[model samples]
Target: MSRPPTVWLTRASMLLVLLAIMLVSGPARAHEFRPALLRLTELADASGQGGGRFDLRLVAPALSTAGAIGEGDLTPIVPAHCELGQLRLDCGSQGLIGELGVAGLDRHPVDVIVELRFVDGTQVTAVLGPDQPTMTLDGTSDGTSGGADNDGVFADYVALGIEHILLGPDHLLFVFGLVLLVRAAGRNTRTLLWTVTAFTLAHSITLAAATLELVHVPGPPVEAGIALSILLLARELACGQTDETARDSPLLSVNESTKVSASGREALARAENSWSWRYPWVVAFGFGLLHGFGFAGALSEVGLPQGQIPLALLGFNVGVELGQLGVVALLLVLLAGGRALAGAVGLSEKTARLATRAPIWAMGGLAFAWTLDRVLGFWG
Candidate 1:
């Protein structure tokens, strides 16, 4: 039995409505993995030796699934003269000037952004990652020393962008769906290029807008919408899949003697008529806009440099594109190798079709699970 066009349209409409509701409703919460923040403010002393007392506020990531944030998860490596207390760090007369490092990055990997304020109102900020756990804190009141400049900002934000995209399960799944859809639709490299470009452009617009405070939306709904987008793509892939040998299969009527059914023709027709199948770029661009908000939310947690906002934004966006391209290239190569190996093994047509369709099924299942989890997260 064939599903009517109206039925498909209705299902798509319902999905859109659900996404809209998610966008409009829900309280905001932390949706993405964000870098930890460590703030240091100098406390003045009567001795006036540049104030050895310092106040500390450390916001670290939760180490356990139970949402328990343990300060012990991150160890602070200070100067030999400085001693870290519960809420205050005493640097003696030296006044907190030395190489600063945070250990235990290996146990819970995340970038740690350090912001230090000197007694003279000079502020310095630096980002520490697992690769580079230490940074120099010169304690200069010049506001230039000990902080990241334009080059450092570019490098840090770019790396953050790449890490976010690669480690972001939801975003990766959506991109994976796009690649699979393009391949299954037999789209050429040009079409794939346009599709990816459209997605990148759309997301870049929203990421900048949201990060710059040009636009504001709740985080949870945006997350739910992203999950919904993946689910919708998965549904489309499952519905419009054709057999591996669909081109070679004979398209004969039921009255004629044919071993293969007309499923291939039906699937091709369905795919051709479907809006997402015909112009996947359009779908990607639409959902990509929603995804940009999610990206901005994560970046917001890291906090951009006031002096180099544009540069940081550009670097992060570029990093995301680089990561996305790498993933696409890797997936294409793996797919090609799998096809070649299957052909060499002389796998039957039915087995080949099953193997080809397995990913779509798996994607759908995972998308559905994510959708449900995100929707439920609205209230929590």
Candidate 2:
């Protein structure tokens, strides 16, 4: 009663194509939490308070001239009416007379990149998001300036890093793929731990290098590559392939014990265990390098001050690791909880096992959509 192998392959291919089209042709919701970039210029003006002058530009897709921005919106750098034009929000005057953060940010959550430049050539840059909406602005010539405090350097950047990873769906998807890869290795906690740690270390290396200007790669390509990595994992997951074979993966025994014949299991094991296949951590380390570049590109744009680079980098990397751990832990809990419920309902173990393939397909579909969108974006 089983479908022919060729028929199954054709059907799967058609479904993949359909999924790609359905996801890419529609209005994309890829960036659900894009942050606002705030560029503040401080210069001395004859009509300025204490001879200080400032002008602000806030850029975000949410800022547009078409709609009405109520008082509950993001607060600009200075006290003045905001006018939105073409994804740009502007406020302040030549004379920065009003007090800093007069109204603070609105009730809602907003992410802002605060950049400050003084006449004395000092630069202070920091990320202001929903977690932090306001900061003091001082524009004194020949005066010391700082954006992030030394005390909070580790904590703040850590929080920012965590926030960025959580907000980024692509990154989350990549991590989810990793979970599938590591956990599938007979749920060997040691393998999973090492793979995750290796990934963290690899990305941390490139993230630091890129942020410090030791390395530079376009953000778009890196993002596209991350999506591609997820797709690769999906393929592996679907094929039941890994760095092991029938003789290697502990799962091979489990697969044999199932209703599946030993011959079929052997085929699955040998094909997956082929020398051409990559180890889980090896794949993670490789793709993680690209993902790190993506992270660095974002962090740079988010305005980490040159002086506080080290602390910010550490904190952000830590945050990313924490987020990754959180996700893996959550997945484990859900899987355990689901299995318990399934058993309670008298579901056969073999039937329940079928659900394991869901993540592979879901990841594949989403990754394909993102890949198509990003590739098209290069020209669009």
Candidate 3:
């Protein structure tokens, strides 16, 4: 037997309310991997003995006065051979070379981007993590940075990109909404491919453009727009109700050998008439541009490696695509398993339909909450 409509609505409402509360109350930037910046510039000495003033500044984004981001002090570890002065390290004739590390990083696990500029115009940039707190400053002028080589830059960015997508609940929800939209429209695999491809291409363009400074948009508005996009998709999914009474419609004669139900024909006609159903790729592509801006905002937080922007950009974009596809695959598998289990348990069609629609409601509720919070954040 099917569940009462009132019960289904009540359960869905409760779930939506809970999700909204959690999303609205939680720290917005809690999961974001905002990197701290560490810059060191070697000062010129009259004797050219490689001893000069060192400007050590650790800049990291923070929200509250609690946690490692707020309380930890970052001090640069200087070479033992050099005399550590108040602002400069004196290495009388050593040329400012040796092991370099940042103190106070052990207290936190944030990635710190290190930039070393020598008097001879040699510049080296590397990413320092808690696991590997120290780097050997070889004091070389070669293109390779002493700590992070080209390969390391690529890999670090790839990992960062993957981590960003996985940690971003909003982006995942948008993709999930896309999947629901495709399934509701009864789209084939080819259509799904087009939809995903369009989204990827559109976002990649904007991400590159925004990162390269070719395009600039306010981050808060972009965030709100991304949430709005998900809400729009949810609306479309909710509107796609199948009609089972139009049995004799000629729309079913496309295949005479196969049985065509009234509901199937009605669905096809609805799909044909609906712009979202017929051209989902267009919708995805348009919204993807807005989402790309959101991605650029995150990328901007973790400054790009100097002289390797292209490589880092490529790696990050590739990582994002990998993470996105993984989410889609995992969701597909979970949905399949859920359907199989429902069938095994002999669930009523109405109950199953309610379960399917619950996620859509959750997505809409969460997206709405996120949009409202981000928009109000503009004032804050």
For model 2, residues 336-368, the per-residue Cα lDDT tens digits are 677667657764333344344445666788788
Question: What C-alpha root-mean-square deviation, in Å, does candidate 3 show against the real structure?
Answer: 5.3
Clash number for each model: 0, 1, 0
Q: Give the Cα RMSD of candidate 1.
A: 8.2
Residue 147 error, candidate 3, Å: 6.1
Residue lDDT tens for model 1, 1-380 = 99955455445655654664455333222234677777778887676535678898777765322344475878777777889898789988777777777887776677887777777666666788788777876755534354466677788778878877887877888888898878766787788778877888889999999988999999888887887888899888877665532422111112223354477667767877888888999999999999999988887765776556898889888888888888888888888788778668766565555555566655665566666777797786
The number of the candidate with the highest lDDT is 1
Stretches of candidate 2 above 4 Å error? 1-33, 44-50, 61-108, 121-126, 136-148, 241-259, 271-278
Error of 2 at 359 (Å): 1.8
Between candidates 1 and 3, the one scoring higher on lDDT is: 1
lDDT for model 3, please.
0.70
Q: Model 2, 70: alpha-carbon shift in Å?
A: 13
**Residues 293-336 of candidate 3: C-alpha lDDT, one tens digit per residue:** 88888767756766788988888888888888888888777877
What is residue 77's positional error in candidate 2, in angstroms? 4.3
TM-score of each: 0.79, 0.73, 0.80
Poorest 10 consecutive residues by lDDT, candidate 2: 243-252
> Which pairs clash inside model 2?
244-273
